[model samples]
Target: MKKSYCPIDTFINVIKGKRKSTIILHLFQGNKRYNELVKLIPDISERMMSKQLKELETDNLINREVFPEVPPRVEYSLTDLGKEIHPYLKGMFKGGIIFENKIDSEEN
Candidate 1:
């Protein structure tokens, strides 16, 4: 947990899992319902989504809030620590898009 330790590896340990990083990145914008995340990442199965969300929550990268109502509701959003990753995530996404586009163009 200390920055003096192997912080980069620790960070990667939390972020590098499949669907985990993307879920956190998407949550950087705002709170999202479980259904919303599934809709956005349609290729992911419901079971996988639930698993990823649980992992992120365990890592303290996300908040899992449940509301009381006739029909219960749950929403997820980035924790403050997770919000701190926003700038980096944005840079990664922007650069990844450009890189992918270049590869596509080269292949054609």
Candidate 2:
């Protein structure tokens, strides 16, 4: 990928899709199958989940491994690149809490 003038915009572009960040955050825990991901994130549809997974795979953020079996076994886990960004994602979680608290206080 070519270097963008705005580094933050470039970073956001990679993870801009719906459910992308959440999906990555989940995979940070460990590998998960398609159904497992669906269960973990109730609001997301199967189609949307599939789409986001493909995009993440394309971006080299996650790995999708398929096994030979009667029913195909597919699992998703973070790639080295993905692992490299895990700390930042965790920091986002902390910032999210702070943002949420501010919103709550404002509404009260």
Which candidate number would show the highest lDDT if scored against the true structure? 2
In the range 1-108, model 1's lDDT, one tens digit per residue, is 323358777776677766777888889878999999999888889998998888888878899999997688999999998899777767878999999999999999
lDDT string for model 2 (1-108, tens) is 335679987877888788888899999999999999999999988899999999999899999999998788999999999989888878888999999999999999
TM-score of every candidate relative to the true structure:
0.85, 0.94
Runs off by more than 4 Å, candidate 1:
1-6
Q: List the residue pairs that clash in candidate 2.
A: none
- Stretch of 10 with least lDDT, candidate 1: 1-10
